[model samples]
Target: MPSKLSEEISPFYVMEVLERAKEIEASGGSVIHFEVGMPDFSTPAVICEAAVRAIREGDTRYTHSLGILELREAISEDYENTYGVKVSPGNVIVTMGSSPALFLSMLALLDPGDEIIITDPHYACYPQLIKIAGGVPRTVRVYEEEGYQIDAGRLRKAITKRTKAVLINSPGNPTGTLLGPDVIRDVASLGVPVISDEIYHGLVYGGEAKTILEFTENAIAVNGFSKLYSMPGWRLGYLIVPEEFVRPLQKLQQNLFISPNPFVQRAGVAAIKHGKREALGMVGEFDRRRRAMLEGLRELGFVLGTEPLGAFYVFVNASGISPDSHALAFDILENAHVAVTPGIDFGQGGEGYLRFSYAASVSDIEEGMSRLGKYLDERKNKSR
Candidate 1:
């Protein structure tokens, strides 16, 4: 039998949808995928060339468990230039990816039975990672009616003596909503530690999302080269933690992962320095696709409560058509050939919605919408 931890964790329905899509493709049918948060773009050549240069220079051996000083320094300068936060290189801890950075930080800060306050319709992995670290997730549901924004008052009410941390994701997964600067500041001022996941930092379309470091030095700024650089396969990320937590997080990382790949870190340095032009370009293209998906879904009768300000997803309310989002997603995949993520995959608050990723090309988005329109029209006609 699997461990209790693994057994209790819920499965990712997105992956299940992907598997079905793959089966359809394998049977010679085409599938336009929107089920997972994956980018369709390849890593820019500039970043790839850096890896080649590193291989030629034989920079393949292990470095400090924290990371190579040069890369950490690059990350430090980046935060200073981008967020106006003068983070010391000593505060940055590089790991295999932001996933481990979050996991290790959870271990560093949370005791067994301790609690973490997470916003609802959150990244599916957040609560599971907290539970795996022996922490209970205290979720505060942010409704679609509120643009999925965090309400300072509700967040304050959720805190307790057991609340060890508040995990905040800006330009968040699923909803693509940004927490207002005031909301972020108010939460930081509550005196609890904050894990600010800025993985989608550079992908904003309609508004700016601030790094928590702008408000307080006590938050952990977790970000990576994945979303912005389109380098998900690189598996490299960094954590900016408070001075006190650095040693403990380093030890946790030392035991789990000695360091991120040497070649990957070498490429990460190039991505930080030279990849911005291309990264910003992707954001514009994503904006175009976002408009296409936004207008198309709304025209098809999927009610989006808010304009997505950042990230690549549209968290749409599908309750007007059906309350069972899980079944609705598969229904569209089987009939329309467009796969979307079921809202329930996010949490209880997501039960009657669907998350559509606009990471595909504009043409693909148009074609998927065309197929979706037909499917929904048929459903409407049959109901009559």
Candidate 2:
């Protein structure tokens, strides 16, 4: 057997849901998508123009293993301005989205037997990434009762001497909860290095999202242009590593990725410098959809946590309808023609919930919610 057959990593189940939705659509069924976390908008005109100019001006070649100096500088300056954290351009490593930066962070930080503590109800990819980087993923259960924030005491209990770091995602996927700055500070006081995924930072609906840099210097901040800038296909993101991790991460970048695409990096520069208005506009749209979905789901008797302050998702409790979220999700897809993510995709503690992304247009979200409402109503009648 091939070595690929011997490994047992779990698949990203929400993506499978998306694939099934696509199959249904190809067969002439209308599938309203709330499963995938992609924005339903085009890249900003400024970013597109910059990429075109870069390519025409012969900026297509690989510039540096760490990325073009100008793009890195822009990212550094953006961080400084946004969070009051001064990061040298040398500490920024531009990668092909936050995914590669995550891989590199794990590789640079963890050894084979090391453990990484992450919250339950985390982004689906976190544990898989830890496993691939040769580390054990230790999960601390976070409840919807607490707005899905990790309990500091429980998290501290999960940390062992072998633990290398704590992984946290604010404006987190599936749950859509933003970690409080005080929680971040408490976690950092443990003296463990923290890896904060702040990809959804600029998409908040209420209070501002805190960058880990504002709370701790012993953190790696992972951010990308995809979510906030509506530049998913651009595959451009950067990491802000502590001064000490800079050289090691750069070496990893040199060997693993060489660099993110040069033209895309130029587009990233345009995004940071001139695309704020366009990006913020998308957040406003998502905010409207978020309110719509929350109201609709509540009418369907789906209990929710406190409204999310950031991110474009609503994580709802479906235990009343079905404790098995996977089955409930499929029921919605098959009967309601609306696709959603089962909480199991996130982690163990997520088993009784469902995640609905409001990154689509208002019409699609409203239609999907209507379908869901009808389906759940019929299910209740049937049970009665």
Candidate 3:
């Protein structure tokens, strides 16, 4: 029999959407992709040049399990400059990606059957990571009407003696909603460790997304270079753990992944020092696409729970069109040739919604929206 662990995990529905979109394109169809969460932009030339230079200079070797000191120090300095928190380099653990940082955090802290709390309609992987770490995921249901913000009172009630951590993602995945300082404090007050995923930090449009370190020293902050630098394929991310977790996480890092790529780490250093300007420019473009997509989606009669203040996604209401977002997603893909993620993939609370990513170019966003609108309009006409 296949391992039970393998059986327990569900597919990342976004990938399925992408694959089906590709199949259509291969069969002589035009597809406008809005399914995946990655930015359509190339990795900044400066960052890529740095990685290439490192490769050409033969800088390929394993870095320290805790990562190169230069990169760690850069991350430490960023916490001070960006979030006003003074983090020591000794506490920073570089991992292959923020996903690993989160997994390591859960593995390092959780005992078998320990529970981690998160908000529903969350990033698809949050609960899976918790379970993979041998912990139970205790989810608090947050609604689209409230911008999918966590209800701290519910979080408080959900906590049992077995709860080990409270995981939060802002400028969040799928929903694109940000949690404010007040909500962070309420979560921290529960006296459980918090894992803050700040991967989409620099992607905010109007307001800012805060690191957990800003509210308390008792949390783990995970941030990375992917979304900011448009460098998802580079696979470089870091974790800022409390002083107490420094060594244990480092040890876990030593075992699971000896170190992330050296060339990538070098590129990461460049991303921090010289790539911010490039990233900011990309963010400007993303903001433009975001606005265009939001306007287009609303015009098509989808209800947005709140304006997305950060990230490049708009999770809109689809219950008016169909209750099964999963089936509806495929129908849109096959008929309209515009791929989008089903809300059911995000969790139960997300079942009646559809998450559209504006990480594509502005033109692509406009075209995808047009196709989707046409498809819906045709469906209405047929029903009438």
lDDT of each: 0.90, 0.88, 0.89
- Candidate number of the best lDDT: 1
The TM-score values for the models, in the order shown, are 0.98, 0.97, 0.98
Candidates 1 and 3: which is better by lDDT? 1
Mind giving the per-residue lDDT tens digits that candidate 1 earns over 1-384?
Answer: 888888878898999999999999999999998876967789989999999999999989988999989899999999999888899999999988899888988999899999999999899999999999999999999988888888888989999999999999999998999888988998899999999999999899866889999999888999998898999878989899999998998888778887778989999999999999998899889999999988988788776668889989999888888899999999999999999999999989999899999988888888999999999899999999
Our model 3 lands, by Cα RMSD against the true structure, at: 1.0
Tell me the lDDT of candidate 3. 0.89
Backbone clash numbers for all candidates listed: 0, 0, 0
Output the worst ten-in-a-row residue range by lDDT, candidate 1.
Answer: 297-306
What's the distance in Å from true for residue 204, model 1? Answer: 0.7
List runs of model 1 lying over 4 Å from the truth: none
Model 1 lDDT, residue 32, Cα:
92
> What is the Cα-based TM-score of model 3?
0.98
List the lowest-lDDT window of 10 residues for candidate 2. Answer: 1-10
User: What ordering of candidates by lDDT runs from best to worst?
Assistant: 1, 3, 2
